[model samples]
Target: MTARVPDAPPHRRQGFGAFVRARAANGALVVQPRMGFSDPGHMRAGLTATRAARAHTVGTVTLDSYTRVGDLDAVEPALRAGTPLNGYPIVTHPGATTRAVLDGVAGPDFPVQVRHGSSLPQHIFRRLIDLGLDATEGGPVSYCLPYGRTPLASSIAAWQECTELFSHARDLGAEPHLETFGGCMLGQLCPPSQLVAISVLEALFFRAHGCRSISVSYAQQTHPGQDTAAVFALRRLCAALLPDVDWHVVVYAYMGAYPVTEAGAYRVLREAAELAVRTGSERLIVKTVAESRRIPTVEENVAALEYAARAATDNTTTARDPGTDSQTYAEAQALVEAVLNLHSDLSRALVMAFERGYLDIPYCVHPDNRGLTRSRLDEEGRLCWAETGALPLGRLVHTGRRREVTAAGLLADLSYLRRKMDREAIGAPPGTELTGSA
Candidate 1:
């Protein structure tokens, strides 16, 4: 039996997606922080601070690890023992208490999103629905593969049910918005084309499951030019494929290794903001100076938010167009077409694509992943696929006798940006040459 969705006031409040769209229409980028606390007072304070920052901002309630993994039993003990969880345990917290945390903080102007890394988010979705929140971010494939050993089939089934459950927010006169984490697959080392393809596919999946408002995500990659091209590709594909759905593009700060130095981290974040502005992305998820060392404090998050806002203001005045004819767009379009041709349903096609190696993630070791594709950074610091495996790119990829990646070479590639930025933080020349598989 299907459980009934709870009733709430028909409050006509503008959701997170609408708020971002309005900001984008006015030439401002919405900056958000990934912050949550085990204590409600602290969470409330953090939200208040984020909303009051000197920038266009949104609020985030990132869930703790125990809630993410579905181990609700561990939550009570941790709370009682006064041990700090990494984020807010939403499912374990009382609904009224959570409401109190967001009181006067989350509204039409300052919208909030609940970000939980849960493959099976039925309970989390219920909590959000009960709390009258209408925005969340995650996808079955993206949340499952990188986080744990959850089977892809099970994750997909869970997400289908959860997506339908969350879509009922419209009944209460609020538009629910979902953001796909697919583009950040494996976070780094995966090439841009596949990332773009996955993000579009997940947005399609959400639409199929009754979500009308959605956001596509892309993480900052090795090269700035490539990243710009990738965002353009994402926007183009979303425009072509999802004409009926209300969608926007979101750029995530480099999700890979972070520079150890404060200056280096801030520089990378500033670059991300500039990328968002140049690509006409509506929103940016930011990282702080303490990203490499620890979970940042509320003050650090505010600082990062303000800095990104300033960067966006400075860069958005002059926009640059990454042409649709770029290599990234061509490759991404081909991948999207190949997956869509597999089946009428996007979710089924995604699973089959993985099984047949039609879609592959580089350096991903999940059981569902084929592990056939490999990627390396080129001389110009662009991520290039060294081995394309069975992806239906035809002549789009040209590796020409792939060479094995050494342990040292892999380490160097992983630390490429971190080392380069750290060196530039002091007085050192920029390193352009990267360690390639060849």
Candidate 2:
């Protein structure tokens, strides 16, 4: 049976969605950092520093791996032993502890979103509910496949329940905002069409489960032109399908590999900011120079945020409109329609779509994934489907020259940006072809 979405009240202006919309309306791009600390004092300090950065910004409480996988026992032991965790242990931390972390830092001007890679996020959601944090990002397939081995069916069921639980945050006077992580599956090499389709489909799932405020995400891919077209396609799809919801697009900086050189890192981030501004994306998730080496310091995060904000301002008046008739848009539309037509229930439809290989992510090895699809970076550096598998785009997209992506080819593609940017740092011309380089 198709579960009807209950009527949601008018959106509150103080919520995360409204805050972002209001900022964007005033000609500001909201930049955020994926930062979290196990210590409440340190987390609070990070949030405070983020708020103090010279940029229009938001804060994030990204959770640690243990809490994300629901291994609370491991988290307790680590915390008790003072072993530093990679991110915040939201589930293991006390409610008062987190409250202290956000007591005065998180407010209208500085809304915070909890970012955790979890398919079963019930424990995490319960804590967020208690803390009245209404903003978070994850999706059934996006969180399930890339992060762990959780069965797709189990993840879908868990996400549905958690999304429904999030929807009720309105009763606590906080409007719930959920961002789909679908566009960033496997972080790189997946064709933009599939990314756009999955993002839109996940947003639809969020809406059908009663979330009224949503944001669709897209990561910066190999080619700027392709990323531009993909973001435009994502926005067009959302505008058509999610007419009644409060929605926006968020651009994540190059997610696969980071450049070793600080200059290269900044160049990539500046490109991402330019992409966000040019494509009319309302938010950008900033990555710092330390990404390729270690967890970025709070100072590095602030520097990246400030720099991206500056780049956005510089390009604010020169936004481009890619229009809706491109190949990316058409392919994404076909994929979304194919999935929706599979079943009346969005969750069931998604499951069946994967089961039948109608929606496949290239290079993803999740057991639920059909593994027939493959993608490669073309000579122009745009991601293309090397093999279409059973994605409904067989006739729609022509794989001009099919080449098997060998192990060496895959490694090269994975490090494409790192090499290109590092070369540029050493006075190589911009946009140099990176065909064969060590």
The TM-score between candidate 2 and the true structure equals: 0.95
The per-prediction tally of clashing pairs is 0, 0
* lDDT of candidate 2 over 1-438, digit per residue (tens): 011122445665478887887788787899999998888888999999999999999999999999999989899889989999999999888888888889889987789999999999999999999888989999999999988789999999999999999997786565789999999988998899989999999999999999988999999998988898899889888888888888888999999988877878888999999998888788999999889888988999999999999989887644455666788998999999999999999999999999999988877888999999998888878898889989998678898778878999999899888888877866777665433222
lDDT of 1 at 14: 72
For residues 364-421, could you state the per-residue lDDT of candidate 1 as single tens digits?
Answer: 8899999899889999899998899899999988998877888888888998888777
What C-alpha lDDT does candidate 1 achieve relative to the native structure? 0.88
Per-candidate local distance difference test: 0.88, 0.88
lDDT of 2: 0.88
The top-ranked prediction according to lDDT is: 2
